[model samples]
Target: MATGKYISYLRVSTSRQGASGLGLEAQRTNIDNYLNGGQWTLLKEYVEIESGKKDDRPKLQEALQLCKATGATLLIAKLDRLSRDAHFLIGLQKSGANFVAVDMPTANELTIGIMALVAQEERRAISRRTIDALAAAKARGVKLGNPDNLTIAGAERGRIAGVKSIKSKADVFAKDCIERIIPLRAEGLSLHAIARVLSKEGILTARGKAVWTACAVKNVIERIEGL
Candidate 1:
């Protein structure tokens, strides 16, 4: 028996996303048109709501599995629509699926590899900048922490806790020992207090355990820095 032809994958980063944006609807519309345009057969369609920064998207993973199992080509509306993880994309490339990002018709393995490397480097640069900014803030005596650490009448504590979570990918851990002091410092609590409250409330870490530390918390904050 012949296997199915094309498999489609769609994703949205946040739960609040609508059914229309992020090219989700556009993909379905275009792929459907492609099928009817008389050259392709539709095998499966997968839709997921998860951050591109995280690796936990079940539907996307399912689509990849289907591609591997059936020897089908995976068609996506865009390349960046895949997760931001270079390692994950590289793994997919090794799986032998012919992936076509709708936006780039001539894209091939070599181009994809180069793109992944660039993405990884971009992430590293952002991380370096964040560290430098934090260090400078601390040097200037600015309180760079979550408002949860402040008292009703005293200065905020130096230590803070943060959590950076991607829907299904890597969760980094860091401790920002140097934080700048922000305005209204005493009016709000620091991240440490907030984390403590969360820990006491039994909020599990990204690894699904009950743990809270300054490094873990900092990782979470840094992960979502620009967004």
Candidate 2:
């Protein structure tokens, strides 16, 4: 249940939808139900009548500013109601305002940031690995122009297998670390406290660092939970 102050942001793809209270009313109801049982206060609500593809949302910026100023949450009915751009969501975390989507209320800036990092790292790692494999295959005399060559197809398969192998290793490590951290979290330890405990107990981060940050702990927690 929500228990703090919140500023709601509602969006409609067209002016007619806004005028008729079609999408807006449903979003408002969702927010109301989310806040129904909590000692929560809805400070203000901002409406935006624009295409989702448009990024220059003046009302969203205003709501964010208010959320930052008042230390209240930027509440929304659904994540899609906000921009689906990864960079936009990352920038929202940097705006120093907390936000919660009714559809994924358990998520927060910390978790969002962790998720972004994992996605970014996965993309970069796989890209680099695939590129490296191509370079290696070329060095081993696999002609790029010969699509008819069985060796070329074999190299392509090898590249895909390498990508999967690397990802599987990363996943296994995260799963192992998260398994250990779960009981500490269940015991009500703060994230920072858990990090300290991990460090003091000689636990290493997913990247093999001897120390752990609160963000790292959050990343690991979300990693295994997501799986």
Candidate 3:
């Protein structure tokens, strides 16, 4: 039932994956299979080599713009390749452009919302499992922490360094989320609607809550714009 001009967007998480065709070929094959009997015109294909965690994707922006301007449907091999972030996906849903993931041709906003929640829970479970595993290892008389056998002061320094590293990564992620939020706001979505979209996408706040409020969304925007 897909009938229109189509713009394809493909993404690989790493440059190595892009170069070595680790996940690219499978995506291409899926797209091809989806388009086999469809009355669709393939406009252009854009490939992006970037982490899904970051939203500063130039190629993806271009593909979406093209779809908007040309009334073309944006096609991707998989939902995750398009984005793992719910906010980004929600923004796209509201952008007045059509998109179809070959892997989930029947997917709609509701299904995407469910998928995002599941994915978020899976990530949290993985982190918990890792922590539990480490605790169990320590209980088995394994000497954990400070593999180099540092002094107390050295251990404090290491802890400080680790906090800084985590902060740095968090800042980068915040900036990326802000980038997506700004565009959505500019597109005339109210803060509440934006928050709803983000929540539906299972995006977490700084405090790791899966739900968002208009005030929370506004605070993030203001903080990021101030920076």
Number of the top lDDT candidate:
2
Local distance difference test, each candidate: 0.58, 0.75, 0.73
Q: Give per-residue CA lDDT, model 2, range 122-165, as digits (tens).
A: 65787799999999999999977745435878788878999998
- What count of clashes does model 3 give? 0
Per-model TM-score on C-alpha atoms: 0.58, 0.47, 0.50
The most accurate candidate by TM-score is 1
Colliding residue pairs in candidate 3? none
Model 1: lDDT of residue 32? 59
Better structure of 1 and 2 per lDDT = 2
> For all the candidates, what are their Cα RMSDs to the real structure?
15.8, 18.2, 14.4
lDDT string for model 3 (1-227, tens) is: 55779998777775545533457668878888888885879998777776866667777788989999998988878786454565456556666678888887887767666766665676678789999999999999998776664788888888999999876655555565686588788899999999998776545565545578999888778767666
What TM-score does structure 1 among the candidates reach?
Answer: 0.58
Q: Write the per-residue lDDT of candidate 1 for residues 8-85, one digit (tens) a residue.
A: 876556433322233456766766554555456668776666666665656767888888888788877666555356
